[model samples]
Target: METRYNLKSPAVKRLMKEAAELKDPTDHYHAQPLEDNLFEWHFTVRGPPDSDFDGGVYHGRIVLPPEYPMKPPSIILLTANGRFEVGKKICLSISGHHPETWQPSWSIRTALLAIIGFMPTKGEGAIGSLDYTPEERRALAKKSQDFYCEGCGSLMKEALLPVTSGSASSQADKEAKELARQISFKAEVNSSRKSVAEPADLSGFNHLPSSPEHQQESTTLAFQDTTPNEVSENQTNSASSSQEQHNQPASNNTSMSPRQRRAQQRRVPTSTNFNQVQQPRVNTNHMGSNALILLLVLALAALIFRRIYLANEYIFEL
Candidate 1:
Protein backbone atom coordinates (compact mmCIF):
# COMPACT_ATOMS: atom_id res chain seq x y z
CA MET A 1 0.00 0.00 0.00
CA GLU A 2 1.36 3.52 -0.86
CA THR A 3 0.13 4.73 2.51
CA ARG A 4 0.93 2.37 5.35
CA TYR A 5 -2.07 1.06 7.30
CA ASN A 6 -1.55 1.17 11.06
CA LEU A 7 -1.22 -2.59 11.72
CA LYS A 8 -1.08 -2.25 15.48
CA SER A 9 -4.28 -0.29 14.90
CA PRO A 10 -7.10 -2.82 14.51
CA ALA A 11 -9.46 0.01 13.63
CA VAL A 12 -7.33 0.79 10.58
CA LYS A 13 -7.27 -2.83 9.51
CA ARG A 14 -11.05 -3.03 9.80
CA LEU A 15 -11.42 0.10 7.71
CA MET A 16 -9.07 -1.30 5.09
CA LYS A 17 -11.37 -4.27 4.63
CA GLU A 18 -14.39 -2.00 4.43
CA ALA A 19 -12.85 -0.25 1.42
CA ALA A 20 -13.36 -3.53 -0.41
CA GLU A 21 -17.14 -3.51 0.06
CA LEU A 22 -17.53 -0.60 -2.35
CA LYS A 23 -16.82 -3.30 -4.95
CA ASP A 24 -20.51 -4.11 -5.38
CA PRO A 25 -20.70 -0.69 -6.96
CA THR A 26 -24.21 0.11 -8.10
CA ASP A 27 -26.05 3.39 -8.53
CA HIS A 28 -27.50 3.61 -5.01
CA TYR A 29 -24.38 3.74 -2.80
CA HIS A 30 -21.39 5.64 -4.10
CA ALA A 31 -18.51 7.44 -2.40
CA GLN A 32 -16.38 9.96 -4.18
CA PRO A 33 -14.00 12.89 -3.64
CA LEU A 34 -15.25 16.36 -2.75
CA GLU A 35 -14.17 18.36 -5.77
CA ASP A 36 -10.50 17.45 -6.47
CA ASN A 37 -9.56 16.54 -2.90
CA LEU A 38 -9.52 12.94 -1.71
CA PHE A 39 -9.46 13.68 2.02
CA GLU A 40 -13.14 14.59 1.90
CA TRP A 41 -15.66 11.87 0.87
CA HIS A 42 -19.34 12.04 -0.15
CA PHE A 43 -21.93 9.26 -0.11
CA THR A 44 -25.34 8.62 -1.62
CA VAL A 45 -27.73 6.36 0.30
CA ARG A 46 -31.30 5.17 -0.33
CA GLY A 47 -33.72 6.21 2.35
CA PRO A 48 -35.77 3.35 3.86
CA PRO A 49 -39.15 2.75 2.28
CA ASP A 50 -42.54 3.45 3.99
CA SER A 51 -40.70 6.50 5.41
CA ASP A 52 -40.09 9.91 3.87
CA PHE A 53 -36.87 8.94 2.06
CA ASP A 54 -38.57 5.88 0.58
CA GLY A 55 -37.61 6.51 -3.02
CA GLY A 56 -34.65 8.82 -2.49
CA VAL A 57 -30.90 8.41 -2.47
CA TYR A 58 -29.74 11.11 -0.08
CA HIS A 59 -26.28 12.56 -0.62
CA GLY A 60 -24.06 13.47 2.32
CA ARG A 61 -20.43 13.69 3.45
CA ILE A 62 -18.66 11.54 5.99
CA VAL A 63 -16.03 13.47 8.01
CA LEU A 64 -13.62 11.07 9.69
CA PRO A 65 -12.40 12.07 13.07
CA PRO A 66 -8.70 12.81 13.39
CA GLU A 67 -8.97 9.80 15.67
CA TYR A 68 -10.88 6.80 14.21
CA PRO A 69 -12.88 4.19 16.18
CA MET A 70 -11.40 6.13 19.06
CA LYS A 71 -13.77 8.87 17.98
CA PRO A 72 -16.99 8.67 16.01
CA PRO A 73 -17.36 10.07 12.50
CA SER A 74 -19.58 13.09 11.72
CA ILE A 75 -21.94 13.05 8.73
CA ILE A 76 -23.72 15.85 6.87
CA LEU A 77 -26.32 15.27 4.17
CA LEU A 78 -26.13 17.69 1.28
CA THR A 79 -28.97 16.57 -0.95
CA ALA A 80 -31.51 15.19 1.53
CA ASN A 81 -33.79 18.23 1.71
CA GLY A 82 -35.81 16.85 4.61
CA ARG A 83 -34.46 19.10 7.36
CA PHE A 84 -30.67 18.66 7.67
CA GLU A 85 -28.55 21.62 6.62
CA VAL A 86 -26.17 21.11 3.74
CA GLY A 87 -22.79 20.08 5.10
CA LYS A 88 -23.96 20.30 8.69
CA LYS A 89 -22.82 17.58 11.10
CA ILE A 90 -25.30 14.68 11.46
CA CYS A 91 -24.95 13.47 15.01
CA LEU A 92 -25.87 9.85 15.78
CA SER A 93 -24.81 7.46 18.51
CA ILE A 94 -21.81 6.74 16.26
CA SER A 95 -21.21 10.44 15.68
CA GLY A 96 -19.30 13.07 17.68
CA HIS A 97 -22.16 13.51 20.18
CA HIS A 98 -21.92 10.06 21.73
CA PRO A 99 -18.26 9.27 21.26
CA GLU A 100 -18.41 7.14 24.36
CA THR A 101 -21.26 5.20 22.79
CA TRP A 102 -19.33 4.29 19.62
CA GLN A 103 -17.74 0.88 19.59
CA PRO A 104 -14.41 0.24 17.89
CA SER A 105 -15.94 -3.08 16.88
CA TRP A 106 -18.38 -1.05 14.78
CA SER A 107 -17.31 -0.28 11.19
CA ILE A 108 -18.25 2.46 8.71
CA ARG A 109 -20.53 0.02 6.91
CA THR A 110 -22.48 -0.61 10.10
CA ALA A 111 -22.89 3.07 10.81
CA LEU A 112 -24.13 3.80 7.29
CA LEU A 113 -26.64 1.01 7.52
CA ALA A 114 -27.84 2.43 10.81
CA ILE A 115 -28.28 5.78 9.14
CA ILE A 116 -30.52 4.17 6.52
CA GLY A 117 -32.49 2.41 9.17
CA PHE A 118 -33.04 5.71 10.92
CA MET A 119 -34.40 7.37 7.80
CA PRO A 120 -37.96 6.19 8.48
CA THR A 121 -37.69 7.89 11.87
CA LYS A 122 -38.49 11.48 12.73
CA GLY A 123 -35.02 12.15 14.19
CA GLU A 124 -36.36 14.35 16.96
CA GLY A 125 -32.96 15.48 18.27
CA ALA A 126 -30.62 14.22 15.63
CA ILE A 127 -27.87 16.72 14.89
CA GLY A 128 -28.30 16.42 11.15
CA SER A 129 -31.46 14.48 10.24
CA LEU A 130 -34.70 16.46 10.52
CA ASP A 131 -38.23 15.68 11.66
CA TYR A 132 -40.92 16.34 9.05
CA THR A 133 -44.43 15.19 8.25
CA PRO A 134 -44.97 12.37 5.76
CA GLU A 135 -46.12 14.89 3.15
CA GLU A 136 -43.14 17.22 3.52
CA ARG A 137 -40.72 14.31 3.75
CA ARG A 138 -42.26 12.76 0.66
CA ALA A 139 -41.74 16.00 -1.27
CA LEU A 140 -38.08 16.27 -0.29
CA ALA A 141 -37.30 12.56 -0.35
CA LYS A 142 -38.16 12.33 -4.03
CA LYS A 143 -35.56 14.98 -4.67
CA SER A 144 -32.87 13.33 -2.56
CA GLN A 145 -31.87 10.66 -5.06
CA ASP A 146 -31.21 13.04 -7.89
CA PHE A 147 -30.00 15.97 -5.81
CA TYR A 148 -26.78 17.53 -7.05
CA CYS A 149 -24.21 19.05 -4.74
CA GLU A 150 -22.71 22.45 -5.57
CA GLY A 151 -19.61 21.82 -3.47
CA CYS A 152 -19.17 18.37 -4.97
CA GLY A 153 -20.65 19.40 -8.30
CA SER A 154 -22.00 15.88 -8.80
CA LEU A 155 -25.33 14.10 -8.58
CA MET A 156 -25.60 11.44 -5.87
CA LYS A 157 -27.13 8.15 -6.93
CA GLU A 158 -28.31 5.15 -4.94
CA ALA A 159 -29.04 1.48 -5.66
CA LEU A 160 -32.66 0.77 -4.77
CA LEU A 161 -32.86 -1.58 -1.81
CA PRO A 162 -33.74 -5.08 -3.12
CA VAL A 163 -36.48 -5.97 -0.69
CA THR A 164 -40.04 -5.28 -1.83
CA SER A 165 -41.09 -1.59 -1.59
CA GLY A 166 -42.11 -2.24 2.00
CA SER A 167 -40.49 -5.51 3.04
CA ALA A 168 -39.45 -6.15 6.60
CA SER A 169 -35.88 -4.86 6.28
CA SER A 170 -33.59 -6.95 8.37
CA GLN A 171 -31.51 -5.45 11.14
CA ALA A 172 -28.72 -7.65 9.84
CA ASP A 173 -28.59 -5.84 6.48
CA LYS A 174 -28.31 -2.50 8.22
CA GLU A 175 -25.65 -3.90 10.54
CA ALA A 176 -23.68 -5.11 7.54
CA LYS A 177 -23.80 -1.74 5.82
CA GLU A 178 -22.92 0.13 8.99
CA LEU A 179 -20.00 -2.21 9.50
CA ALA A 180 -18.73 -1.44 6.02
CA ARG A 181 -19.03 2.33 6.54
CA GLN A 182 -17.26 2.02 9.88
CA ILE A 183 -14.45 0.05 8.31
CA SER A 184 -13.89 2.73 5.67
CA PHE A 185 -13.94 5.49 8.29
CA LYS A 186 -11.64 3.54 10.62
CA ALA A 187 -8.96 3.54 7.93
CA GLU A 188 -9.18 7.33 7.78
CA VAL A 189 -8.89 7.61 11.55
CA ASN A 190 -5.77 5.44 11.75
CA SER A 191 -4.12 7.21 8.83
CA SER A 192 -4.84 10.62 10.34
CA ARG A 193 -3.33 9.60 13.69
CA LYS A 194 -0.08 8.78 11.88
CA SER A 195 -0.22 12.02 9.87
CA VAL A 196 -0.81 14.22 12.88
CA ALA A 197 0.19 17.97 12.68
CA GLU A 198 -1.77 20.17 10.26
CA PRO A 199 -3.06 18.69 6.99
CA ALA A 200 0.08 18.95 4.96
CA ASP A 201 0.12 21.08 1.83
CA LEU A 202 -1.95 19.42 -0.92
CA SER A 203 -0.28 21.22 -3.83
CA GLY A 204 1.70 18.05 -4.57
CA PHE A 205 -1.04 15.67 -3.48
CA ASN A 206 -2.62 12.99 -5.60
CA HIS A 207 -4.89 10.45 -3.85
CA LEU A 208 -5.66 9.85 -0.16
CA PRO A 209 -7.25 6.46 0.43
CA SER A 210 -10.28 6.58 2.75
CA SER A 211 -8.42 3.86 4.63
CA PRO A 212 -9.11 3.80 8.38
CA GLU A 213 -5.45 4.45 9.04
CA HIS A 214 -5.59 8.19 8.35
CA GLN A 215 -6.52 10.28 11.43
CA GLN A 216 -8.32 13.62 11.12
CA GLU A 217 -5.47 15.68 12.60
CA SER A 218 -6.18 18.62 10.32
CA THR A 219 -9.85 18.54 11.30
CA THR A 220 -8.87 18.60 14.95
CA LEU A 221 -6.52 21.50 14.26
CA ALA A 222 -9.37 23.34 12.55
CA PHE A 223 -11.73 22.76 15.48
CA GLN A 224 -9.06 23.50 18.09
CA ASP A 225 -8.15 26.90 16.72
CA THR A 226 -10.77 29.29 18.13
CA THR A 227 -9.97 31.07 14.90
CA PRO A 228 -11.02 29.28 11.73
CA ASN A 229 -7.73 27.97 10.34
CA GLU A 230 -7.17 26.68 6.82
CA VAL A 231 -5.14 23.51 7.20
CA SER A 232 -6.42 21.78 4.09
CA GLU A 233 -6.62 22.87 0.46
CA ASN A 234 -10.42 23.14 0.70
CA GLN A 235 -10.28 25.33 3.81
CA THR A 236 -7.65 27.58 2.19
CA ASN A 237 -9.74 27.80 -0.97
CA SER A 238 -12.88 28.71 0.99
CA ALA A 239 -10.96 31.21 3.13
CA SER A 240 -9.34 32.77 0.08
CA SER A 241 -12.71 33.01 -1.62
CA SER A 242 -14.16 34.88 1.34
CA GLN A 243 -11.14 37.16 1.71
CA GLU A 244 -11.19 37.93 -1.98
CA GLN A 245 -14.76 39.16 -1.67
CA HIS A 246 -14.00 41.18 1.44
CA ASN A 247 -10.87 42.84 -0.03
CA GLN A 248 -12.58 43.68 -3.30
CA PRO A 249 -13.06 47.46 -3.66
CA ALA A 250 -16.69 48.51 -3.58
CA SER A 251 -18.02 48.89 -7.12
CA ASN A 252 -19.90 51.98 -8.37
CA ASN A 253 -23.25 50.76 -7.07
CA THR A 254 -23.99 54.15 -5.47
CA SER A 255 -26.71 54.79 -8.04
CA MET A 256 -28.54 51.61 -7.05
CA SER A 257 -31.94 51.94 -5.37
CA PRO A 258 -32.22 51.45 -1.59
CA ARG A 259 -33.46 47.88 -1.94
CA GLN A 260 -30.65 46.97 -4.32
CA ARG A 261 -28.13 48.66 -2.06
CA ARG A 262 -29.26 46.65 0.95
CA ALA A 263 -29.25 43.47 -1.09
CA GLN A 264 -25.73 44.21 -2.28
CA GLN A 265 -24.54 44.73 1.28
CA ARG A 266 -26.12 41.46 2.37
CA ARG A 267 -24.69 39.63 -0.63
CA VAL A 268 -21.15 40.56 0.34
CA PRO A 269 -19.91 37.55 2.26
CA THR A 270 -17.80 37.96 5.41
CA SER A 271 -15.00 35.56 6.29
CA THR A 272 -12.27 35.90 8.88
CA ASN A 273 -8.97 36.17 7.01
CA PHE A 274 -6.92 34.23 9.50
CA ASN A 275 -3.95 33.89 7.18
CA GLN A 276 -3.55 37.37 5.74
CA VAL A 277 0.00 38.61 5.12
CA GLN A 278 1.10 41.64 7.11
CA GLN A 279 0.97 45.19 5.67
CA PRO A 280 3.29 48.13 6.37
CA ARG A 281 1.96 51.01 8.55
CA VAL A 282 2.36 54.72 7.69
CA ASN A 283 4.27 57.11 10.00
CA THR A 284 2.27 58.82 12.81
CA ASN A 285 3.21 62.34 11.54
CA HIS A 286 1.66 61.64 8.13
CA MET A 287 -1.52 60.32 9.73
CA GLY A 288 -1.81 63.34 12.05
CA SER A 289 -1.36 65.80 9.15
CA ASN A 290 -4.04 64.05 7.08
CA ALA A 291 -6.45 64.07 10.06
CA LEU A 292 -5.95 67.84 10.69
CA ILE A 293 -6.47 68.74 7.00
CA LEU A 294 -9.65 66.69 6.83
CA LEU A 295 -11.05 68.32 10.02
CA LEU A 296 -10.35 71.90 8.72
CA VAL A 297 -12.06 71.18 5.39
CA LEU A 298 -15.14 69.77 7.21
CA ALA A 299 -15.35 72.92 9.50
CA LEU A 300 -15.10 75.29 6.58
CA ALA A 301 -17.80 73.44 4.65
CA ALA A 302 -20.15 73.43 7.65
CA LEU A 303 -19.75 77.21 8.25
CA ILE A 304 -20.37 78.04 4.58
CA PHE A 305 -23.48 75.83 4.46
CA ARG A 306 -24.85 77.40 7.69
CA ARG A 307 -24.40 81.02 6.39
CA ILE A 308 -26.03 80.21 3.04
CA TYR A 309 -28.99 78.59 4.75
CA LEU A 310 -29.50 81.63 7.09
CA ALA A 311 -29.26 84.10 4.18
CA ASN A 312 -31.84 82.12 2.18
CA GLU A 313 -34.21 81.94 5.16
CA TYR A 314 -33.96 85.73 5.84
CA ILE A 315 -34.75 86.59 2.21
CA PHE A 316 -37.69 84.21 2.14
CA GLU A 317 -39.09 85.77 5.35
CA LEU A 318 -38.78 89.31 3.90
Candidate 2:
Protein backbone atom coordinates (compact mmCIF):
# COMPACT_ATOMS: atom_id res chain seq x y z
CA MET A 1 0.00 0.00 0.00
CA GLU A 2 2.91 2.38 0.73
CA THR A 3 4.56 1.77 -2.67
CA ARG A 4 1.25 1.91 -4.61
CA TYR A 5 0.20 5.27 -3.10
CA ASN A 6 2.45 8.18 -2.14
CA LEU A 7 2.41 8.34 1.66
CA LYS A 8 3.30 12.07 1.50
CA SER A 9 0.05 12.86 -0.32
CA PRO A 10 -2.69 14.34 1.91
CA ALA A 11 -5.38 11.94 0.61
CA VAL A 12 -3.26 8.88 1.33
CA LYS A 13 -2.19 10.25 4.70
CA ARG A 14 -5.80 11.05 5.70
CA LEU A 15 -7.08 7.62 4.67
CA MET A 16 -4.25 5.92 6.56
CA LYS A 17 -5.12 7.90 9.68
CA GLU A 18 -8.84 6.95 9.36
CA ALA A 19 -7.84 3.29 8.90
CA ALA A 20 -5.82 3.36 12.08
CA GLU A 21 -8.60 5.07 14.04
CA LEU A 22 -11.29 2.60 12.92
CA LYS A 23 -9.12 -0.52 13.25
CA ASP A 24 -11.35 -1.77 16.08
CA PRO A 25 -14.98 -2.07 14.90
CA THR A 26 -17.78 -0.33 16.84
CA ASP A 27 -21.04 -2.10 17.70
CA HIS A 28 -22.87 -0.23 14.90
CA TYR A 29 -20.23 0.20 12.12
CA HIS A 30 -16.79 -0.88 10.91
CA ALA A 31 -14.76 0.26 7.86
CA GLN A 32 -11.17 -0.23 6.65
CA PRO A 33 -9.18 0.31 3.43
CA LEU A 34 -8.48 -2.80 1.42
CA GLU A 35 -4.94 -4.22 1.63
CA ASP A 36 -4.47 -3.97 -2.16
CA ASN A 37 -5.89 -0.40 -2.51
CA LEU A 38 -5.89 2.45 -0.02
CA PHE A 39 -8.62 4.31 -1.99
CA GLU A 40 -11.18 1.48 -1.81
CA TRP A 41 -12.72 0.45 1.51
CA HIS A 42 -15.08 -2.33 2.71
CA PHE A 43 -17.56 -1.50 5.46
CA THR A 44 -20.22 -3.29 7.50
CA VAL A 45 -23.06 -1.43 9.24
CA ARG A 46 -25.75 -2.67 11.58
CA GLY A 47 -29.25 -1.39 10.79
CA PRO A 48 -30.87 1.33 12.90
CA PRO A 49 -32.87 0.21 15.94
CA ASP A 50 -36.75 0.33 16.10
CA SER A 51 -37.10 0.17 12.28
CA ASP A 52 -37.80 -2.58 9.76
CA PHE A 53 -34.07 -2.87 9.10
CA ASP A 54 -33.28 -3.49 12.77
CA GLY A 55 -31.17 -6.63 13.49
CA GLY A 56 -29.77 -6.49 9.93
CA VAL A 57 -26.03 -6.62 9.33
CA TYR A 58 -25.24 -5.11 5.87
CA HIS A 59 -21.97 -4.86 3.95
CA GLY A 60 -21.00 -2.21 1.39
CA ARG A 61 -18.10 -0.67 -0.60
CA ILE A 62 -16.72 2.88 -0.42
CA VAL A 63 -14.61 4.04 -3.37
CA LEU A 64 -12.73 7.26 -2.63
CA PRO A 65 -11.62 9.75 -5.26
CA PRO A 66 -8.06 10.99 -5.65
CA GLU A 67 -9.18 14.32 -4.15
CA TYR A 68 -10.21 12.51 -0.92
CA PRO A 69 -11.87 14.84 1.63
CA MET A 70 -12.20 17.60 -1.04
CA LYS A 71 -14.46 15.20 -2.96
CA PRO A 72 -17.03 12.67 -1.78
CA PRO A 73 -16.93 8.86 -2.09
CA SER A 74 -19.27 6.54 -4.04
CA ILE A 75 -21.21 3.98 -1.97
CA ILE A 76 -22.43 0.59 -3.27
CA LEU A 77 -24.44 -1.84 -1.17
CA LEU A 78 -23.33 -5.45 -1.44
CA THR A 79 -26.04 -6.80 0.85
CA ALA A 80 -29.73 -6.56 0.02
CA ASN A 81 -31.69 -4.73 2.74
CA GLY A 82 -34.60 -3.79 0.37
CA ARG A 83 -34.07 0.00 0.64
CA PHE A 84 -31.43 0.19 -2.08
CA GLU A 85 -30.44 -2.09 -4.95
CA VAL A 86 -27.52 -4.40 -4.42
CA GLY A 87 -24.25 -3.57 -6.26
CA LYS A 88 -25.58 -0.17 -7.40
CA LYS A 89 -24.08 3.14 -6.31
CA ILE A 90 -26.67 4.87 -4.12
CA CYS A 91 -27.34 8.65 -4.23
CA LEU A 92 -26.96 10.54 -0.96
CA SER A 93 -26.00 14.05 0.11
CA ILE A 94 -22.88 12.58 1.72
CA SER A 95 -22.13 10.50 -1.41
CA GLY A 96 -20.34 11.41 -4.64
CA HIS A 97 -23.67 11.97 -6.41
CA HIS A 98 -24.17 15.10 -4.31
CA PRO A 99 -20.70 16.51 -3.69
CA GLU A 100 -22.12 20.02 -3.31
CA THR A 101 -23.51 19.08 0.11
CA TRP A 102 -20.52 17.06 1.29
CA GLN A 103 -18.09 18.59 3.74
CA PRO A 104 -14.39 17.87 4.23
CA SER A 105 -15.00 17.37 7.94
CA TRP A 106 -17.23 14.35 7.29
CA SER A 107 -15.51 10.93 7.30
CA ILE A 108 -16.30 7.33 6.41
CA ARG A 109 -17.81 6.86 9.89
CA THR A 110 -20.17 9.77 9.25
CA ALA A 111 -21.22 8.30 5.90
CA LEU A 112 -22.02 4.95 7.52
CA LEU A 113 -24.05 6.62 10.23
CA ALA A 114 -25.90 8.71 7.66
CA ILE A 115 -26.77 5.60 5.69
CA ILE A 116 -28.24 4.00 8.80
CA GLY A 117 -30.24 7.13 9.57
CA PHE A 118 -31.61 7.26 6.00
CA MET A 119 -32.66 3.58 5.79
CA PRO A 120 -36.09 4.22 7.35
CA THR A 121 -36.85 7.10 4.96
CA LYS A 122 -38.95 6.78 1.80
CA GLY A 123 -36.89 6.17 -1.35
CA GLU A 124 -38.77 8.81 -3.34
CA GLY A 125 -37.86 7.17 -6.69
CA ALA A 126 -34.22 8.20 -6.55
CA ILE A 127 -31.54 6.23 -8.35
CA GLY A 128 -30.72 2.88 -6.64
CA SER A 129 -33.63 3.47 -4.24
CA LEU A 130 -36.43 0.97 -3.48
CA ASP A 131 -39.93 1.12 -1.99
CA TYR A 132 -40.39 -2.43 -0.72
CA THR A 133 -43.18 -2.99 1.79
CA PRO A 134 -42.47 -3.32 5.54
CA GLU A 135 -43.00 -7.10 5.42
CA GLU A 136 -40.55 -7.46 2.55
CA ARG A 137 -38.00 -5.26 4.23
CA ARG A 138 -38.21 -7.18 7.50
CA ALA A 139 -37.76 -10.47 5.66
CA LEU A 140 -34.78 -9.13 3.76
CA ALA A 141 -33.23 -7.82 7.00
CA LYS A 142 -33.00 -11.37 8.33
CA LYS A 143 -31.49 -12.60 5.08
CA SER A 144 -28.79 -9.84 5.00
CA GLN A 145 -26.80 -11.63 7.71
CA ASP A 146 -25.81 -14.54 5.46
CA PHE A 147 -24.87 -12.24 2.51
CA TYR A 148 -21.16 -12.46 1.66
CA CYS A 149 -18.66 -10.45 -0.35
CA GLU A 150 -15.61 -12.01 -2.13
CA GLY A 151 -13.34 -9.15 -0.99
CA CYS A 152 -14.57 -9.00 2.69
CA GLY A 153 -15.13 -12.77 3.20
CA SER A 154 -17.81 -14.33 5.46
CA LEU A 155 -17.40 -11.75 8.28
CA MET A 156 -20.78 -10.10 7.62
CA LYS A 157 -22.46 -11.96 10.54
CA GLU A 158 -19.94 -10.75 13.16
CA ALA A 159 -18.71 -7.56 11.46
CA LEU A 160 -19.24 -5.33 14.52
CA LEU A 161 -18.19 -5.62 18.23
CA PRO A 162 -20.73 -6.13 20.99
CA VAL A 163 -22.62 -2.96 21.90
CA THR A 164 -21.22 -0.96 24.83
CA SER A 165 -23.39 1.74 26.41
CA GLY A 166 -22.11 5.39 26.41
CA SER A 167 -19.51 4.74 23.70
CA ALA A 168 -18.20 7.58 21.43
CA SER A 169 -19.94 5.92 18.44
CA SER A 170 -23.31 6.65 20.04
CA GLN A 171 -22.54 10.40 20.07
CA ALA A 172 -21.36 10.25 16.44
CA ASP A 173 -24.61 8.53 15.53
CA LYS A 174 -26.65 11.39 16.99
CA GLU A 175 -24.70 13.98 14.98
CA ALA A 176 -25.12 11.94 11.79
CA LYS A 177 -28.88 11.66 12.34
CA GLU A 178 -29.16 15.44 12.75
CA LEU A 179 -27.17 16.08 9.59
CA ALA A 180 -29.36 13.69 7.60
CA ARG A 181 -32.53 15.35 8.86
CA GLN A 182 -31.28 18.80 7.79
CA ILE A 183 -30.43 17.63 4.29
CA SER A 184 -33.83 16.02 3.82
CA PHE A 185 -35.65 19.10 5.10
CA LYS A 186 -33.84 21.43 2.70
CA ALA A 187 -34.68 19.19 -0.25
CA GLU A 188 -38.37 19.16 0.69
CA VAL A 189 -38.50 22.97 1.00
CA ASN A 190 -36.92 23.45 -2.43
CA SER A 191 -39.36 21.04 -4.07
CA SER A 192 -42.37 22.73 -2.45
CA ARG A 193 -41.25 26.19 -3.64
CA LYS A 194 -40.85 24.92 -7.18
CA SER A 195 -44.28 23.28 -7.15
CA VAL A 196 -45.95 26.51 -5.97
CA ALA A 197 -44.08 28.82 -8.35
CA GLU A 198 -44.90 26.72 -11.41
CA PRO A 199 -48.66 27.10 -11.02
CA ALA A 200 -48.34 30.85 -10.32
CA ASP A 201 -46.41 31.33 -13.55
CA LEU A 202 -48.96 29.31 -15.54
CA SER A 203 -51.90 31.09 -13.87
CA GLY A 204 -50.46 34.46 -14.88
CA PHE A 205 -50.81 33.45 -18.52
CA ASN A 206 -54.20 31.77 -18.03
CA HIS A 207 -55.94 34.79 -16.46
CA LEU A 208 -55.02 37.36 -19.14
CA PRO A 209 -57.94 38.88 -21.13
CA SER A 210 -57.98 38.60 -24.94
CA SER A 211 -56.73 41.55 -27.04
CA PRO A 212 -60.11 42.40 -28.58
CA GLU A 213 -61.86 42.64 -25.19
CA HIS A 214 -59.06 44.77 -23.74
CA GLN A 215 -59.13 47.13 -26.71
CA GLN A 216 -62.94 47.51 -26.53
CA GLU A 217 -62.83 48.36 -22.82
CA SER A 218 -60.06 50.90 -23.37
CA THR A 219 -62.07 52.56 -26.15
CA THR A 220 -65.18 52.80 -23.99
CA LEU A 221 -63.23 54.39 -21.13
CA ALA A 222 -61.62 56.87 -23.53
CA PHE A 223 -65.06 57.97 -24.80
CA GLN A 224 -66.39 58.33 -21.28
CA ASP A 225 -63.39 60.48 -20.26
CA THR A 226 -63.84 62.92 -23.19
CA THR A 227 -67.64 63.19 -23.15
CA PRO A 228 -67.83 65.98 -20.54
CA ASN A 229 -65.17 68.10 -22.32
CA GLU A 230 -66.98 67.73 -25.67
CA VAL A 231 -70.31 68.72 -24.13
CA SER A 232 -68.78 71.77 -22.39
CA GLU A 233 -67.10 72.90 -25.63
CA ASN A 234 -70.41 72.64 -27.61
CA GLN A 235 -72.29 74.60 -24.92
CA THR A 236 -69.63 77.37 -24.94
CA ASN A 237 -69.82 77.64 -28.74
CA SER A 238 -73.63 77.94 -28.69
CA ALA A 239 -73.54 80.63 -25.96
CA SER A 240 -70.93 82.68 -27.86
CA SER A 241 -73.01 82.48 -31.11
CA SER A 242 -76.18 83.61 -29.29
CA GLN A 243 -74.32 86.55 -27.65
CA GLU A 244 -73.03 87.65 -31.08
CA GLN A 245 -76.54 87.55 -32.56
CA HIS A 246 -77.89 89.63 -29.63
CA ASN A 247 -75.20 92.36 -30.11
CA GLN A 248 -75.62 92.76 -33.90
CA PRO A 249 -78.58 94.13 -35.97
CA ALA A 250 -81.19 91.65 -37.11
CA SER A 251 -81.38 90.51 -40.74
CA ASN A 252 -84.56 89.91 -42.80
CA ASN A 253 -86.89 87.39 -41.12
CA THR A 254 -87.83 85.07 -43.97
CA SER A 255 -90.13 83.22 -41.61
CA MET A 256 -92.51 86.26 -41.45
CA SER A 257 -95.37 86.83 -43.98
CA PRO A 258 -95.48 89.97 -46.16
CA ARG A 259 -97.85 91.78 -43.77
CA GLN A 260 -95.79 90.81 -40.73
CA ARG A 261 -92.61 91.88 -42.49
CA ARG A 262 -94.14 95.29 -43.28
CA ALA A 263 -95.33 95.63 -39.68
CA GLN A 264 -91.85 94.76 -38.43
CA GLN A 265 -90.28 97.26 -40.88
CA ARG A 266 -92.54 100.00 -39.47
CA ARG A 267 -91.81 98.96 -35.84
CA VAL A 268 -88.06 98.83 -36.42
CA PRO A 269 -85.81 101.03 -38.66
CA THR A 270 -85.76 99.97 -42.39
CA SER A 271 -84.60 101.29 -45.84
CA THR A 272 -87.61 103.69 -46.02
CA ASN A 273 -86.66 105.02 -42.59
CA PHE A 274 -83.18 105.72 -43.94
CA ASN A 275 -84.81 108.00 -46.61
CA GLN A 276 -86.57 110.00 -43.84
CA VAL A 277 -83.17 110.35 -42.10
CA GLN A 278 -81.85 112.12 -45.34
CA GLN A 279 -84.18 115.21 -44.86
CA PRO A 280 -81.11 117.42 -43.96
CA ARG A 281 -79.57 116.63 -47.40
CA VAL A 282 -82.72 118.00 -49.07
CA ASN A 283 -82.49 121.26 -46.96
CA THR A 284 -78.87 121.69 -48.04
CA ASN A 285 -79.93 121.50 -51.72
CA HIS A 286 -82.64 124.08 -51.13
CA MET A 287 -80.09 126.56 -49.61
CA GLY A 288 -77.89 126.23 -52.69
CA SER A 289 -80.86 127.08 -55.02
CA ASN A 290 -81.66 130.28 -53.03
CA ALA A 291 -78.03 131.53 -53.38
CA LEU A 292 -78.21 131.04 -57.21
CA ILE A 293 -81.40 133.10 -57.51
CA LEU A 294 -79.80 136.01 -55.47
CA LEU A 295 -76.77 136.12 -57.83
CA LEU A 296 -79.09 136.30 -60.96
CA VAL A 297 -81.07 139.20 -59.48
CA LEU A 298 -77.90 141.20 -58.76
CA ALA A 299 -76.77 140.76 -62.40
CA LEU A 300 -80.12 141.96 -63.79
CA ALA A 301 -80.02 145.11 -61.63
CA ALA A 302 -76.47 146.05 -62.88
CA LEU A 303 -77.53 145.61 -66.53
CA ILE A 304 -80.53 147.99 -66.15
CA PHE A 305 -78.42 150.68 -64.44
CA ARG A 306 -75.81 150.60 -67.30
CA ARG A 307 -78.59 151.02 -69.97
CA ILE A 308 -80.08 154.11 -68.17
CA TYR A 309 -76.61 155.79 -67.94
CA LEU A 310 -76.17 155.30 -71.75
CA ALA A 311 -79.53 156.98 -72.45
CA ASN A 312 -78.60 160.13 -70.36
CA GLU A 313 -75.20 160.54 -72.17
CA TYR A 314 -76.93 160.52 -75.59
CA ILE A 315 -79.40 163.23 -74.52
CA PHE A 316 -76.61 165.47 -73.25
CA GLU A 317 -74.67 165.10 -76.52
CA LEU A 318 -77.75 166.07 -78.52
The lDDT for every candidate, in the order shown, is 0.58, 0.77
Q: Name the regions of candidate 1 deviating beyond 4 angstroms.
A: 1-13, 26-28, 32-39, 150-154, 157-318
| Residue 178 accuracy (lDDT) in model 2 | 83
Q: Model 2 over residues 129-163: C-alpha lDDT tens digits?
A: 99999999999999988877889674777788765
What stretches of model 2 exceed 4 Å from their correct place?
1-3, 164-173, 186-318
Using Cα atoms with residue i matched to residue i, what is each candidate's TM-score against the true structure? Answer: 0.46, 0.57
When superposed on Cα atoms, how far off is each prediction in RMSD? 22.1, 34.9
Residue 223 of model 1: what lDDT? 52
Error of 2 at 273 (Å): 75
Location of the lowest summed lDDT over 10 successive residues in candidate 1 = 270-279
